[model samples]
Target: MLHRKNTKLINKLSTALFLAAITLSAPSHSKPVKNTSSPKKVVPAADLSAEDKLFVELREAAKVNDVAKTRTLGSKLESHDLSDYVLYYQIKPQIYDKGAQARVDSSADAAVEAFLKVNAGSAIADRLRNDWLLVLGKRKDWANFDREYVQFVLNDDTQVKCYAIQSRQAKGEDSKQLGHELKNILLDAQYFGEACPEAAQGIYRAGGLSKQEVAAMGRIALENNYEGLAKKFGVDDPIADTVKKARTDPAQAFREFEKKEWRTGRENTAAAWGVIGQFLAKKLDRNAIKAYRLQHEAGHHQLLSPESQEWKVRTALREGDWRLVKESIEGMSPAIRKRDPAWTYWYGRAQKELGDEALAKETFQALIEQFNFYGQLAREDLGMKIHVPKRVIPDESLVKQMSENKGFARAVRFYDMGLRFEGNREWNWELRTLSDKQLIAAAEHAKRIGLYDRAVNTADRTKAEHDFGLRYPTPFKESLSPIANSIGLDSNWAYGLIRQESRFIMAAKSSVGASGLMQVMPSTAKYVAKKIGMTNFKVSELDDMKTNLTLGSNYLNMVLQDLDGSFALASAAYNAGPSRPKLWREKLPRTVEGAIFAETIPFNETRGYVKNVLANASYYTALSSSKSPSLKQKLGMVSPKASVLSELP
Candidate 1:
């Protein structure tokens, strides 16, 4: 389904009006000023061709599942340029009902096959095939599923992957290899909608998985808050009851589990303790280490899922228990330890803390080349600083060629209609086979078209050629710099926050109602406006670039002051709220490195947000100034604060 956010239209219209009002209100001098700039020409909605309007309306009808309206609109667009999209929308409601295993009749199958055959090799064909594959898998139609699954390009759906495994099992394929594949896919329990849990049950019945392995899967599911999935693994009442208790009072759960003996076996017992540890760890409860210790003493640490193991390490980091951190990371599967740079960096830090200087140096040396948040930290750990890489300018001819690409044109049209999901899929689908130089050109094209998010994402895909300008484009520096500087905030830091907040999308509105370039929430915007003594500041004005930057910069400065000038804490406050970082800070036992505080933030979104914002700021600094400060320098120390002044919401 297309996710349409009407906030974009409201923002765009308000921005235009705000600019027009400013132009009209400006004082005129006696001397006539010559205007050399050509006015931007905007095509009115009425100017759109009849076919274009019908196609857009068809998309809107499909978005709300208006089957009758969609059919009516689809009929009008039968001869349109994008009739394939209309066809997809017409048949989509029949097969893709949310949460229902759609029963496909012979006619439905014939229609889908005809669509796929007609639109062969197109992105929408692959998309339709993907959707149809899920229904076939659910219906246990193995022959058709196998045929369509192979043709399904962008096989990125976890449920579809699980169903494919089940289809293999039904065909008497090797159970051992299929079981292994199923286990890897089942690791992501959060997206396991019916198909994965069923596949796991089938594997267990076939003796391809042990009881302990199934119990471990249940524990991982419970850890991800998918209690329904856990029950599907046959988790008993005792273990489920303990998990319920652990959600609110993990320490009590840990204590009770340590004393009571369950008949459900050691494996279930270990699972309970692992989950309790995860909950306790998120709350920064010291007993989290004790719960993990109980699991470790039972020799069931190996049974803990990778996510559970990572939480154990995070809890240890918060408590300053370096030995536990090192032990937990070493106990992780070699694949996981090598895959996540965060764990690798933490492992190196643990090694250094445990006095293994040579091993620590080796770990940091290898990690420094990764060029991410942790990579920057690893560089500083190795006594080096970030240096701006030589910028690779894209060929102008290649950039011009990108303008002629059909996929990009479709993506731009979807973007203009506020269908971001379809827009992003269309945009990224064409990027699969491009060379690094071509990728650079594509990113430059996205930038020129004001698709800043796509520009950043595309530029970030480059393996060798680097262009920091395209990756971190500063679109409104003239206005942003003065606003940030006037309030004594670093403009680079503001730019970094803006880049992470919205990717410079002018009409960006988050699900929680944050608006415009900086994604300022209405309440926060109003509060900042009132505090700054601005009159008649409407919530609608938050969409204007100047207003958003001003309010966001002021709120950021306020948080920075409240948090005692720590960028790490302020960034967290910006993503989450001021109260959360305050509570997080108040829980700190003593002064610690800012990186440690950021790594251990309970909310996953805010933790990554803080790291990315600070890392982005460091890169922006390197790009803008001669004296580049290290990421560590920007992350300054975070300490326990007794009181903070601001009452920011």
Candidate 2:
């Protein structure tokens, strides 16, 4: 089902790309017909304009894999910006052909060289070069790989980095240097794919990796539910095996885990039990707290991994046990405890909840040193203002200079032709070379061009000279505020969520079919529209500013009331659905601090959504009121729903 959905999305994007190309080829004043192809007055291929004819024939040739025709048509593409891309397409398939390796390598090298010669400093060229490098790495062509590797601007690919390490080792480099590089990439659990695993194996063979390093890698895999990865690294044991089983069926896994005679190792056994506890926390199993207590009672509390301690925190929070929450947090490794702001904030909240006022205030004061989501909440707790940084106005001269840049011009053209994704790539590629000041200038240009979402994102890339205005622009003020007001919703909160949901991209549609600034799903929109007495509502209306705002606000308000006016819970419900949050709340043994409840949310997406929305709302509120807003008040205690309501939205 997932594969089918992904394929459908790919087909949709492909169709959109084709339509965009046709649109771009046409005159500016021409009306786009419903049927893009075979339009009412189609021009003959010979009669088509030069650029249009080249593009059309080149696409047709590539579609049929007519390499000869592609090269012929591509040669006539003229000295234009797209010529290199056309040539790349002409050569791309040959690189992947099941021909002789030397021939394939030669073709790929030529393609990279030619493309870079013409389209130097372009994102498309970089992408093509990366693809070529992958082929070179696969074929073990170190000479070509070494030559191209240094020129790879992004250098962000883990696989490419792995190959580079492999290349160095092939050149008789010491294993110590190779091991140093491998260790850095190994810790990034996000990319434990073939390249890194192979690199790890190579490092292990050379005595570069220790037993603890291998186990740590395996632990990361188990924690992230990737058991096969642990197996691939040859770090498997009963504990790791039990962790995998727990992910699928916690009760069955636990029953089997405990049946073995105790004596393997205390730490290993506790680690296995901890994985089960984490699973139980995710499933909200009734026995989660009991299981955690049993593990602790067996004197293995010192061996509990960060994941195990995290679940212990969740299990305690479910019952609003402040003492246990503090204990669980304290039990975690100091490194883990110090790094996670969520845990830091919760520890303070737990102290406050348990009547340790001075300690709570001290914790929050220390935690507020970093300006982040939790810092905002800490400020709210301390009654301090949430300061929106002064807007940094870009200089007109710099903005003008960026406006006339060739890359910027091409990006704007792509956007004009409705190729948003392509336009974004072009825009970001240019941004890579810009300083913070230049990025701000480009953001101002994006705003002037009415690409508000692009403007927001462009400004967001800046690390210094914080510009809150560009980051949190209220594009549809008149429409959004009134709708929010009518529904008795917080205008700041409404806009905050909209900003995150769609980045204020009014016509944006999510991959899942949710549309407009609020990203309301079709069914949800329809239901809300009807409930609000919108008799003539259509799914199409969901993309309109007034309609989407009204419907989305109403739905938000409905969930807010349904969940007892707890904004954090309501925000989670808004993202995940009303039913899941409702069920998740019911899993709680008692009322828990709202921030703790939010951090413990099972769905990563919803947990992030809630936190970001609240944080955004805090900033937006500060911007609007010229005073601090209380994120603490927004995230009030979240008790379980009074009773389960069978009827749901």
Candidate 3:
């Protein structure tokens, strides 16, 4: 996930931090082991030995495709403790080139094979195998790909899976099985990179899949705005053009569509309508309801993807059309309606509105114990409050065991060097086989090391035991609470936003320049500082704990006041600017429950952000007060905006 462009910034920060800090001694160990009793001392990269520094440099160099530098640094660290990773960095560029044709150096194959043989069963080796498989896959080297893929421990990459399917087809494998596998991979349209589309086309050409099936996949891709993918499936020439027109001017596109007869058949026609309806629904336009209605009337609702089907329901939710909501949800794939709690809850609400109380109650009961935003709302619908599971503490010996884990130590080293992608991969690889107790202990270790993000994520993975303290940590409560209180903002809400924004990482910086705990944009920070009368404020201070908390809290309070104190609206505004939420509220046909509004948020990120912030706030409140929290009270109602906002940055 870490891109080449960001490597420079990461390197600068890592280098400065390394030079400024000291390393602490680690426990003696032969091989990287699992779990610890006490917190292992963190070693700053600056204090690491020459070999360790070279390893970090090698990682940095490899990230930016500096092959020469990477090879030099890697050679120096060949005898280091984590030499495998160094070797991986050295060979990775030779096999994998992003956005370029796969060109494997002649020596890379043998070198990678040797490395994989030596570090077999290790995470680093598996990673190298994965990279090597990609190259082999691109070259249509089925012999190498088939061999390496069988040993690939984590078959999680979409592109890799697509390549495997291609390999299977090349070897005259069962068409039915390959088609089924290709369908599953193609359905993940958001990540539909080059490989999957190519495979789909190949499978279709080879009579493994039908034209209509491939077209449907293309439609799904178009629903996700993947025109390139749609083109690859041979569905873009006419349908993609209509979808593009619909995006720019839905009403006009609808008129044009109605006036024309398609040679592409009912499926493509329905797909176009579904896409138009999806775009219009995001704008809160009633025409979206009409578009979907036409699609349904044509008996082609089945053609719409799960996402488009959900948008049809969202459009109805904004219109308070319960009948349409029920109908749209019914048209969705059973897998979607049954799997997504949002749809189930909304379906229940629709049933209740249609006087089907028994069905509604059953649906609400099913979600009462889910412990999410929808689950909380479902519980409230059943006349109950949010319940926090009792905390389970891990033993000190377990914590000590986690601290001694070499994988975690490597993860910590990567984190110290600002390489979160590698750090997260290392941390998660170690967590694969951990028990509930071990998970809690790992989370505790992460918490002690100021890896709050890792701590929260690790605690969240526990299946049986729970720990609210680790899950909803209030790291800077002493400083954050006073600022929130002084600014008339709920401290719990601030904590939730901070937790979601930066996970308590003091030096966290977003892609768009939002910095520090609250992830405040530089522009927004400047505006807040000017408004709060903080003279001579510098943007550099946005990374300062006090400055970030103060400014972010003030901005949040401003949005809350401007938006009629609706937490859902204010939370959405905080994530997606103050103006967009106002536009969303103004376009609403009628007042709706806060949960409905949050669900219908146009921006996917903001929609999830609002729900998470509110949910996290509820948990924080419950943890702090030792009482059941009222999530409904926190969500309140979201009505049409009064339109009084004059200036908000």
Relative to the true structure, how large is the alpha-carbon lDDT of every model? 0.78, 0.72, 0.78
Q: Per-residue error at 303 for model 1, in Å?
A: 2.6
Give lDDT: candidate 3, residue 209. 81
Better of 1 and 2 by TM-score: 1
| Cα shift from native, residue 447, model 3 (Å) | 1.1
Q: Rank the candidates by lDDT, best first.
A: 1, 3, 2
- Per-residue CA lDDT of model 1 for 596-641, tens digit only, reads 9998899989998999998888889988999866898888888887
Q: Write down the lDDT that model 2 would get.
A: 0.72
lDDT of 1: 0.78
Cα lDDT, model 3, residue 466? 86
Query: Which candidate gets the maximum TM-score versus the true structure?
Result: 1
Backbone Cα, N, C clashes tallied per candidate: 0, 0, 10
Q: Which of candidates 2 and 3 reaches a greater lDDT? A: 3
Q: How many backbone clashes does candidate 3 have?
A: 10
Q: Write the per-residue lDDT of candidate 2 for residues 519-543, one digit (tens) a residue.
A: 9999998888888899899998887
How far residue 596's Cα lies from its native spot in candidate 1, in Å, is 1.0
Q: What clash pairs does model 3 have? A: 35-401, 35-402, 36-399, 36-400, 36-401, 36-402, 37-399, 37-400, 37-401, 38-400
lDDT, model 1, position 157: 82
